[model samples]
Target: MAVTRPLLDLVNVTAGYGQTPVLFDVDMSVAEGEIACLLGRNGVGKTTLLRSIIGLNALTSGNIYFNDADITKAPTYKRARKGIAYIPQGREIIPYLTVLDNLKMGFSASGKKAKRIPAEIYDFFPMLKEHLQRQGGLLSGGQQQQLAIARGLMCNPKIILLDEPTEGIQPSIVQEIEDTLRRINIEKGITIIVVEQKIEFARKLAQQFFIMEKGAIVEKGKTDKLADSLLHRYLAV
Candidate 1:
């Protein structure tokens, strides 16, 4: 179900913390409506790549194009407004806020006139609908992850960047998350770039894949063409 045209493109992107580079000349593209997975062992710059796309990490050298516009120099909030939603690692929903409020907070990034949470949001996460008044901190890890994804959708993003979504969840919820992500892509036409460590999950969820090592992309292709040898070389601990 991947679209042919690229929705997000990163060309020769090098980014990092102050005076220390983490991503090196990384070039990648996510086709419109495609689910692309970024895979690497710990400390291989997978998270940094996602951060770069969301504008949280500045590029030392490169160009990022989204919807055919250069946004490499844009600020984080501006990137969100430009329809890039980032769900960072740890499912960082405001702990004290009610679930409903957390979702409402997404409006700050969207700048949409409609202030009401769309009914479709609840349709996607009926569990959240049932717990609208509950505090975000009270949800289980899997539920919190769902809330994080749901909050991102409130902005009606064209693309969603997810970091380590399956890190701490149980197997059942992991399957649910995977199924939900696929449904989101097919039903909502949202492009997804997920930073993931689980090989099976990545293989099942992504149509395209990129594997990184020591801050640079070493391999990439359609997921169907991903060879086990590559995983053994780059992903083996």
Candidate 2:
């Protein structure tokens, strides 16, 4: 039998801003086509871990491997071009740009000429098509999150990191986003590493879980028995 390696792996990674270490000796792995969630209380370095994976926060020590290749030192653009996309905590859509233009920006990472918005994008977000001419900032919070996710999809990434995607969004729209993400994962075979505070959202979407505390992962395993007390320590927030 062949031993399959994880698509994304972090070996003893330590990262942070300047000299301050936000992640300490973090070891994590995510196999291809898997949905994994990082759960943690606020200020526990969940976002920092995503930043490290995407090359925004340089690893002070240790290594990062994506698709079994070392990317610890790769620049942010290089990582983006290599099929890693990040939708940050705040849904950083360009406010002044039209929704269409914001989606167009995803093509930049693909190193491909901007063409018509991919049909699949509209399929996943039909509402965006209706509001294509509107400025991104004009959209409500839920709509903007959808736009940001749509933009991430436009990059045609193999792996995407989502930070607190449900934060500040209406439950109805959150459900929509969850359904779309499941479709994307099942249809496109994309891998996701999401940082989420909601247990129901995490349990519904991610098959695996990693719980973080004080800038380090304290527990990790399959989603079975989500009521386990260990999870409460982090989920309590």
Candidate 3:
């Protein structure tokens, strides 16, 4: 099948922290309303690529485009304002803040005055409703992860970049997260680019898969056609 015009594109991107380059000439795209996964072993530059796309890490070379607009140099706030939400690897919710407050913090970059949580966000993660007043740090790992995602949804983002939503979480919660992601894609039409180390998790959710090795794309194809040998080579257990 022909690939659609990408909602977000990274063309020949090379980025890193300070003097060391981590991502090398990375090129990837997330199509509108599709769940695309970046799969790789640890230290393969998966997080760096996500950071580059979100403007968290400076790119030494190349360009990034979102909704066809060049955002290579856009500040982190600028990217957030432009409907890109990032959920980093650690589910970095503000431990001291209430769950409600954590979600509100995500709207800080919205650049508009808005009151109340978006009903749709709560509809997707209903567990958050009961814990609105609870401290973010007090929630279980699963709950915190849900809050992290709900916080992203509060931004009303066009695309969400998820980094390892299944890591360090219980199997039941992982399934819950997978279901929620599918609903976000099918019902809300949000484009999702997920970076996951777990092959099964990515395989279950992604329409297309890209495997990274030593900071470069080593293989890519529709998820259905992913070769077992390639998985073993790039993501062996």
Candidate 4:
């Protein structure tokens, strides 16, 4: 069954860096517990759309609603507190911080209640529990990616925005990440909006997808309806 209410909604949103526009009147939405993907080629403004939702990229014009409440102008911190989490590209794990401290940083960054790593986090990434004292910089790209995601889960977000979760990741870890994401959505009912360019990856995870072209959503539909022919048409640029 489809969710009766939207967990995240972006209506005709225009946003970008100062004096420069990247996303132009983009319209998108994700239902409660739904897994959606923003699909596009490079420089199509998909990342900008995700950043705009988290308040990292300021909106010049538009209204954003979370749980049906307007929050277009809310600060990033406030948005984080409201159960929205973002794990941008490049992983961005602090090189020197211990794995344990990095996990705590997620809770701290959101101002979420919970000083210690939740037991569920260990369940999500058992390796993190093993390397609690290991420095983040020393872990492999896959392990760091796992840590980055685990950090987001520590915040207990209702929805998570992941930009290219599998980019540069090894195939084995990519599969693990895919299974973990499905588990998160099915087991916890958390909504997931992942920005990805890989067809094989996105097709497996997203129930629906929005295809971006030249800064706008040119096509969208249920994952079952998306075809390789469409990919070659709108997303092959």
lDDT of 2 by residue, 80-123 (tens): 88899999999999999999999999999878889989899999
**Model 4: lDDT of residue 14:** 93
TM per candidate comes to: 0.96, 0.97, 0.96, 0.95
**How do all the candidates rank in terms of TM-score, highest first?**
2, 3, 1, 4
Pairwise lDDT winner, candidates 1 and 4: 1
lDDT per residue for candidate 4 within 146-183, as digits (tens), equals 99999988878999999999989899999999999999
- Worst lDDT run of 10 residues, candidate 4, spans 1-10
Candidate 4 runs further than 4 Å off: 1-5
Which pairs of residues clash in candidate 2, taking residues 3 or more apart in a chain or in different chains?
none
Model 3, range 159-194, lDDT digits (tens) per residue? 999999988999999999999999998998999999
Q: What lDDT is reached at residue 215 by model 3?
A: 93
Q: Give me the runs in candidate 1 sitting further than 4 Å from their true place.
A: 1-5
Q: Across residues 76-160, which tens digit of lDDT does each residue of candidate 1 receive? A: 9889999999999998999999999999988888887548899988888889999999999999999999999999998999999
In model 3, the runs with Cα more than 4 Å from the true position are: 1-5
In candidate 2 the C-alpha lDDT for residue 24 amounts to 96
- Point to the candidate with the largest lDDT: 1
